[model samples]
Target: MEITSKLLNSANAIIEAKIDAKSIENKLNDIAKITAKKVKIDGFRPGNVPVKIVLDRYKDDLLKDAKQELFKKAIDDGLKDIDKKTDEILGEPIFSKFDEKDGNIDAQIEISFRPAVDVSGYEEVIPEYSTPRVTKKEIEEKINELLKMIAPLEKIEKDVLESGDFAKFDFEGFVDGEAFEGGKAENYILEIGSKQFIPGFEDGMIGLKVGEEKDIKVKFPADYQAPNLADKDAVFKVKLHEIQAKNIAEKLDEETLKKLVPNEEDITIEKFEERIKTQIKEDKFQKLLNEDLKPKFVDAIVEKINFDLPNVIVEQEIDLQFRNAWDSFSKEDMEKFRADKDALTNKREEYRSDAQKSVKLTFIIDELAKVRKIEVSDNEILQTVYFEAYRYGIDPKKHLEDYKNQGILPAVKMALIEEKLFNDIFKKDKKEEKGE
Candidate 1:
């Protein structure tokens, strides 16, 4: 066999493989010999059939099978030689036409070659990073949020249900004067201002006395998931039983301060405030590390590299972007989106450019990892996987295996490297800012 390669472009290559006719003949003879042992005819038992009979009965099939096997082996050998000469493959090879008419087998294979990029000067190109400092307002806001999470609800002796007050009520809903399923409740506590019920239900509860009964009319949303109720009009007979309001904790009080810091027996308001401040600082630092350092680092590396990416990588990135976009869109809106084929096609092409840039950036990052010898230890990966699984309320071992099978292991490694790079950059910037 002989192979010749021609570069179609930086991203694609064409290889021509020529297999010897004598070799093809030898394979066909070997296949025929193997088939003779299994051949059975009308007059002869299996393995005792004549060679001439076997040749007549199975010659065409054996030849076809032999040719395919020989071609596959030749292609494998050719690809191995190509990879040995050129470092790595970027994508799967696409085979073109095969000629079998004139006793010689000639085939063409098209492959996408990995991009060769010269990546350097990333450190110089990247902007100096600066750590964000937590502010008093931020800490105060965090404390307020924490207080809201632990806020207590107290019963109110109000005469009427009002906005921002919870109303305990008995209600029954009907469509066309007939009751509907899942439309009746007894002593249900619902916030008067919250749109947890149908649109008009909450509004109708307002201005109603504790013992008053009223008929509330509402229409289900057009995109409601229940097929029977979507866009349907209904009347609800509502009776208000009681009213309640939220009693938010005071920041300066002793009882509230103890709740804020549960473990500290003698925790003062000042100590609670200090803990909130510390947590705010840590959260702000992480946010800044993600928002500021990551983009800057990626931009810096992208600027230092120049290469054309394989189409497959770019397509994969585009798929990721599309999935993310689809996730954010409402179900009704997504149905409309799917109907707009031309618009979606245009949007996909527009996203493809962004995907291409992402693929190029990924290539640069991988090169950086190689140059820096960045590696994540098995223990580190396991710990990180377990931590993420715990956050999602999943079993760690199952999540780890799922992640590995889904090819997320490389993504995890890449994330670790990016995190390390960001830390290094931020530390250097901090030192410079402090005049160290």
Candidate 2:
């Protein structure tokens, strides 16, 4: 095979190879010999099929397999001939010109390589965010939230049902003078003004006294989950049995503190409050990192750094993002993409910018990691995998296997490494600010 290569850009190239007819003939015959052992023709014994018959009978099948093999071999030999490693290749090679052309097995393959980028200005592209502060008010709010979670309902005998009150009742709903399925309940507790029930069902309970019998008219929303009830007006014959209000916990008493921190030994009210504050701060920090800080940092880096991106990598990122989003689309939504061709075309163009940004960021992160001599440790990867498994209630070993099978093990490590890189930068910046 005669091989030659041309650099299209910093991160992409075209490798052209030409094969002699004799080589093709030789490989074809060798494949035919192997095929002979697997064939059992009506007139021939097993492993005794004639070579000519095998070639004639399965020429197309044999040639397809031979072509793939030749392409792979050509790629390996051609890469070595040009001094490139398989590890440096980003994605699969595209056979741009593969056919019997110009009296040779002429093929032109397009390949994407990991882009070489100088991320010197990456440290300057820091995300602007303050570590979320837990205030006394926030702690009080959290305490109130806990109060809501554990609050008991107390029966009311005198005061009329008011908004934010829970009312216990028995009701039979009627649509067009007929009771419907799932429209009747006995001793159902409905929250007034909470909108837990259908439209007007909760609001209609307001201003009612205990033992009061009233008819609440409500309409099910047009886009209701149950198709049968959609946009239907119904009358509920409600007989209020009792009015109940939340008895919120305002003081962290001995028993309440124990209940709040059941697993903590020798815990006090101050300790409980401190623990709650710490938990809230941790939750907010993680949320801020994921939702705001990370994206801002990535965006800032992408804006400041410039590099030639592999077109194939960008295209693959676009396709992957499109597929992941498409998986969530409803049948009707998917039909819209098919019916409105312009919508899909416009959508692809819209995703193009994000795809390019994602690709560029990937290359930038890799370059940063290399320049900084940063490495992701096996223990870190194991911790991340185990944390994910614990979150999703899956076996960590099986989840790790699944990640490997899906070709995302490297991606997982990259994600952790990227996070660690940013965190280290933050730490350095903080220390510098403190003149440490």
Candidate 3:
């Protein structure tokens, strides 16, 4: 038996091993001896089968077990020679080469480990900013939105359709002097300014009275989804049926406040205002995290921090991303992939840069999590899963089981940790900026 190890990179290493014929025979005999004690052959009583008979009868199965044992032993011996620990290894070891020749086996296994990262001055990259504050006007606007949401739509006693009013009308569009498919509808409810139809179609309805018929001229945009109608002029024959508007209250009332926040007990105008204020504040904070601060922070860290990622993990990420986006591939591209194996590789290269960045961010977040002492326990994860399940009307246990079966529980936990870590960092930074 011979084993040697080589460092491929800081985060990856390879081990080459060769097992002689005598060593393979010894391993097979050792396994056979163990199997003989538990054997139940027809010609022999249980626990009384000869080792020679056991080796001959289950040669293939025994040889497989022997090879596995030898492989593990080789890894152990190689790790010892390289002064590396088992727990330091990351993911499964990939077998780069495994071949048997002349009753001897040669194997080369590649192993990876988490790269070392120095996140000492990571906070320097975080931009200084004032804490986001919600205003009274914003709170009032949110309250008005809630009122509009709960208000009932009532028929407006008016002759003409107007902007901001709901118009229920019948319309049939024509192209090149002929009616087209999906170009006719009866009693279609559209908000005048909603722009649900092609340009000039909704605007053409303005000032038109109930039972009034008019041919509204419009043109479909060049990039319209339907190529047949793209960049083409069309006339929609329209007849306004009715006009409706939400009967929202100008002032806050007890009934409306109760409707605005159904979960609140003993709701009042003042309490509802406070609730809306808090909600607006929280929403602003979330927007800051999601749209503004988080992206900037991630970009800064990824640019500032440098480390070599394990190649296996990067490949895994690329594969996962490709699988996730498989549905979005064009039919022709999918067919190409099916017809040619290399076509898949060519397509996967498009995601390589993004995958590398994603994998790098993952490791960076991992290191930052440790630096900040951020952790999500199993209970916290389960609680989150249960909350999500209830939100989506799914059974909690089944949701959790699906996550486990799909092998994404760790990814979910990491996401939670990353969110928590970012929130903590941003909050602390805000405090520091405010001289708190």
Candidate 4:
């Protein structure tokens, strides 16, 4: 066998392998002999079939099988040679061109090679780490939100309904003076300024007195998801029946505080407030850390690295991103997405670039992990598995098995390693800061 490789692009290679006809013929002859011993022929016992008759009956089939086997062997041998020369095999080989004219066989195959990246100075590219500070005002705001969650609503007798006030009304909506489906309701309670109904609806209810009937006209927005309602005008004949006011409770009392903490006998409003503040502060700190770290890390890594990615890997990443996007879109949005094929295609290409960046980043992270000798122990992995299961409300054993089968265990390990890397880098920087 003889093999030659041509560089098609930075990420693609074309390999052409030529196998000896004599070797192929010998394999075909061996197959024919094996078949003659087992295969039955009319008027002749199994092993007694004539060689000429066996050749006549199974020559084509044997040759085809032999060619496939030889092609695989040639490709494997060629790839082995390439790997020996370059020390890596990145993606699946794409086979093309099989010639069998006049008993002479020649085949051509194409394989994609992973690009080697020279990654360094990722720390310089990523931003410096700074801990986020939680303020007193933010803590107060969170407490207020908690109070509103426990607030109650109260009924009010009023002469006129106003914005921010809940109004109970009986209404029938008409499109062009004709009633439409889902256009009428009795005793419907709506907040006048909530904008929950069609445009101009709540505004028309303002200043409406109980028992007063009025026709409210409104137009649907042009980009409304409902096809029948888009840009359509409708009139709702509303009769205001009642008005209600939102009632907010005062600060947590002994009873309310007890209800919030049934298990803890020593619970107090001040303790609860401090707990809320602490939780809020942790959440804000994590969010700020991610926002500051991710872009800087990617930019730094990309700046230091220069290499082409295998097309197979990029395409695979593109498919994963497309599936993720499709899963996140609503069914209605998906229909609109299918209708706009060009837009979706553009989105796929954009995701391809993101996939490339992700691949490049993975390479850099892996390199860093190797240099730092980062490792995750079995005990640590078990702890992580249990924590993740509890967080997601799943059984630990079942979730761990599922993660293993789905091949996500490595990803979890990588995440753990990356966290360690970040901590180490941050500590080193802190030491330098202290020294300065």
Give me the runs in candidate 4 sitting further than 4 Å from their true place.
5-14, 19-70, 83-89, 95-121, 170-186, 221-231, 258-266, 286-291, 306-308, 315-355, 365-436
What is the full ranking by lDDT, best candidate first? Answer: 3, 2, 1, 4
Write down the worst ten-residue block by lDDT for model 1: 427-436
| Tens-digit lDDT track of model 3 for 86-121 | 898888888889899999988889888889988878
C-alpha local distance difference test of each model: 0.77, 0.82, 0.87, 0.76
Candidate 2 residues lying further than 4 Å off, grouped into runs, are 18-25, 40-43, 97-106, 128-131, 171-185, 212-239, 283-292, 324-350, 366-436
Per-prediction TM-score to the true structure, in the order listed: 0.69, 0.77, 0.76, 0.62
Residue 26's C-alpha lDDT in candidate 4?
86
User: How many clashing pairs per prediction, in order?
Assistant: 0, 0, 0, 1
CA displacement after TM-score superposition, residue 282 of candidate 4 (Å): 3.9
Q: Positional deviation of 3 in candidate 4, in angstroms?
A: 3.2
What TM-score would candidate 3 get against the native?
A: 0.76
How much lDDT does candidate 4 score? Answer: 0.76
Model 3, global lDDT: 0.87
Please give the ranking of all candidate structures by TM-score, highest first, separated by commas. Answer: 2, 3, 1, 4
Candidate with best TM-score: 2
Point out where model 3 deviates above 4 Å: 153-245, 262-268, 330-350, 428-436
Backbone clash pairs for candidate 2 read none
Model 2 lDDT vs. the true structure? 0.82
TM-score of 2: 0.77
